[model samples]
Target: MRTSDAQTLIVEKNPNPVADSERDALLLNPVFGRVFTDHMVTIEYSRERGWQNGKVRPHAALQLDLATLVLHYAQEIFEGMKAYRLPEGGSTLFRPGANARRFRNSAERLAMAPLPEELFIESVRALVRIDQKWIPGGDGAALYIRPFMIATEAVLGMKPSAEYLYCVVACPVGSYFKVGSPSVTLWISDQYTRAAPGGTGDAKCGGNYAASLAAQAEATREGCDQVVFLDAVERRWVEELGGMNVFFVFDDGSIQTPPLTGTILPGITRDSLIVLARDMGLAVREEPYAIDQWQEDALSGRLREAFACGTAAVVTSIGNVKGRQYNFTVGDGGAGPVTGRLKDALLDIQNGRVEDRHGWLDRL
Candidate 1:
């Protein structure tokens, strides 16, 4: 195992790990977030002694007190990233620095102790190196890495905890959605609001996701793949989906997505696509879009395509949208050419199939 100069990580190998054959069989059908690797990384923090006791240990359940701060106050934040297998050999991380910075920002927003960027990157790198075998190959497959922080102080109150625990765990995943389904249906939610102004929408925290579950359940009941939220002010402006950021392709060779006005998560994948689209000579705008306008444009043949992007789902086209009073289809109800091209460009950079001009790939 390799150790970075920033921190010396003590490694404790998992005893009685699964046998090689069983592990291979399990890897044959890797489910997202279901089958985890044998080891995990943990680092403790406190007001007295900043960050300490960084180590790689066997994957196991955490022992928490009955009145933990995170359980009560929800002072927690997490990041999602992946380690892709290189075409020639080994594996590499895609834009870990960006994830680290975002994690810090989330911690700041949640009033939790901010983790050092180097430590965050080193922790993720250590886990990936130790569990490199868990990384699946081919398209739509990689080792999904989750780095998270929690307020672990036992004396819970209405304030942030004095102690914290930062951990990293990984699981091999095949695909976020069904392989054959290149496009997905969405339910425009009017009864629920994902985040309000001056909320934690820009932070990658669990509370935001928990709040969106009701709307997601409503979408599920409506027989839709996901739920798209409108703005909380008027419930008319298009915001984002439950977990992924959305994009719109116009017939006039331009792209539009909801602006980040402190009510939407600044997705790394979303930013990457914006840059990739601009590189391809397409005008991209971060502006507010209304649900009524979306339906009107789709119906009038002005909206060419719609799609969502994230770390897990990559890029997924929006085929059909359904609401209580309206329904519409985008671009023949299928994936459009621009959506395909952008998806391929972004995926190619992540998978090392194209030149990484932005210095995003961190080779291991």
Candidate 2:
């Protein structure tokens, strides 16, 4: 276990890697999260020793005790990011430091040991360097990076885990949703609330996503591509989608989204778009939007477009919205000009197609 001086991560090459030909085949048109690279990164953490023994090894199954704390208590957090293949023949991570900061915040909220921000970023970069060959080319394709931490302490008592495992894995993935779709329909989840003001709503933890599955399933039954949740208290203000933050474009060229008042996730993509929109001389508002107002505005031509933003799905336009009592379409029910412009601005910066004026990309 020789330590890497540059990043302090120990490197171990895979003994039996997949053939290049086979890897190329898997990279072609791979489904999201289905095809993985050959190597992964892991680091152990303890209350006493802190973080140590970081390693880059072959990807394999994790051996956890039957009574692991995460299995019982669900003290887990994760981040989703991508490594884009540059046109000039290298790879880079998009705003990984932001993800690292979010990961630390989630850890603090969950009472888990927080991995250092530098370690988190380096762990991801190390894996990307080792598995650079697995990065795929083509529109909407990149190496999807998943960095997660789980409570590994084998205790049944209801307390924070004293030990944890941080792991980073990479997978070759295409579009998260159907590719080339003009837009997607969303179902309003009146029966379910994603998170409350006092809960883990703002944290990017596994439990929050676990709690949303039921509502997501309900949306699927209703023939919608995704679910949009309302606030828990009033149940009237629109909050966000099942796994993404939402934005609305009004006819006056102003955009608004739900405020991060302890209930919203404060998405990196959401933050980036806000910055980009402001740079482009557009008004971006962080405030609450009501469901009734949304429907009424769309019908009256005041609401020109609606879209959801996140790391997984990027920026996806909301063409149609439906609830129990009402259904409406925004501006002819297709991707709007504002949505397209924001998506293009984001994608261009991410893929290195334009100047990275904001210094968002971290090249490997």
Against the unseen true structure, what C-alpha lDDT does each candidate score?
0.92, 0.92
| Candidate 1 residue pairs that clash | none
- Provide TM-scores for the models: 0.97, 0.98
**lDDT (tens digit, per residue) of candidate 1 on 111-191:** 998888988998999999988888887778999999999999998578889999999999999889888886999999989
Q: Which sections of candidate 1 miss by over 4 Å?
A: 1-6
lDDT of 1: 0.92
lDDT per residue (tens digit) for residues 1-364 in model 2: 1223326987999999999999999988989998789999999888887788899999999999999999999999999999999999999999999999999999999999888888889999999999999999998889999999999999898999999999999999888899878899999998999999789999999999999999999889999999999999999999989899999999999999999999989899999999999998999999889999999999999999999999989999999998797699988888999999999999999999999999999999
What TM value does model 1 have?
0.97
Task: Name model 2 segments beyond 4 Å from true.
Answer: 1-6
Q: Which ten residues in a row have the lowest lDDT in candidate 1?
A: 1-10
